[model samples]
Target chain A: GAGVSQSPSNKVTEKGKDVELRCDPISGHTALYWYRQRLGQGLEFLIYFQGNSAPDKSGLPSDRFSAERTGESVSTLTIQRTQQEDSAVYLCASSLVFGPPRETQYFGPGTRLLVL
Target chain B: AQSVAQPEDQVNVAEGNPLTVKCTYSVSGNPYLFWYVQYPNRGLQFLLKYITGDNLVKGSYGFEAEFNKSQTSFHLKKPSALVSDSALYFCAVRGFTDKLIFGTGTRLQVFP
Candidate 1:
């Protein structure tokens, strides 16, 4: 069985450029999550998709950040006009389900975005 | 609003010695605690989690965590440390479901 996978393992782009990071969740994983890990800091939640619905988008840092998932499948996070401050490792994770008792979230290798 | 704190920025231990990474959390209700380890150039790997029933929960690679409700702590422990275990460890708490609240992470360095 495959785990979560992300594309563009490393990306270096100029400030004000836009980048789209892709994430392929594990098969049958209904819950997908996106998190940003800045240098020497904890992971900051970005967005989450349960099936095709985004129940929580409050974690998006600003209007420039948006993510979409197509029903328990691939998800794309688009950072419109990226800034230097957006330099970080974007990680994707998926779980069988989330809430209640407890479920483990499997993480991906992550896409390291560097804004020049 | 829930929060988690890994008090120590780093923990150093000799191989074959016991190791402990401290994590404390604040949540409105019952807390679901979890441990994750991230090796260099790798994503986070699930270590273990504590939801209910057990105070001491054992996880992969002989790692275990003790959930102390009174102390509001869930510390990851290993009886014997290994150099290969040197990595970044994180503790997370899920209270509300928007997302899991993760700690700042603690770098564990196991020396041989």
Candidate 2:
């Protein structure tokens, strides 16, 4: 794809329901990232995927949040037993490089999840 | 740890006037700075970045930012503001590692 693509642009789920968000990064990009943005708040880092290596899950808010990536391609973010506090816009980004002085990150349109 | 800070919640500027969005960062090593803009119902668009060259880095959409080492700041600026430039701006900082930390963001409102 020419740019990062995310699925289910908007989602409204009841509290305690599980939700899955998908992301497809640009071809040949080596790095991917997930972030959460609450209403009127900043983007919060969630996880990072670099190739087939173990993903950097340091930013996951809790055990209910998990993510996986297939090689260097599509990635999915799953939230189990979502809470009201979990309602936010989930964003995906990809970069051509992932090392020091990394280049610009191309962001997806983002999935707006509303936990009612 | 690496982090970026955008102190202002919002900035209002008149068309054709100069505009600035302040940003500051804290990192362990040399800093890699970036600026991104976002419009309503859209994704973030890359504006510019500062790596290892000149203090002033130019980017897309006639936007530019100055990197200040002593002040630990990288402020985005434009000589003239346009109403179309109204959008949300984010500042990010990455150290010598792969991690990129972002600031809260600043909402820029340009009036005609």
The alpha-carbon RMSD values of the candidates against the true structure, listed in the order shown, are 0.9, 1.0
Model 1: CA > 4 A from native: none
lDDT of 2 by residue, B1-112 (tens): 6889999999999999999999999998888899999899888899999989899999999999999999999999999999999999999987765656889999999999
True contacts kept of each: 0.74, 0.79
What tens digits encode model 2's per-residue C-alpha lDDT throughout A1-116? 48999999999999999999999999989999999989888888899999878899999999999999999999999999999999999999999977754777899999999999
For model 2, what is the C-alpha lDDT against the true structure?
A: 0.92
Candidate 2 versus the native: TM-score? 0.97
Clashing pairs in 2: none
Highest DockQ model number: 2
**Residue A26 accuracy (lDDT) in model 2:** 95
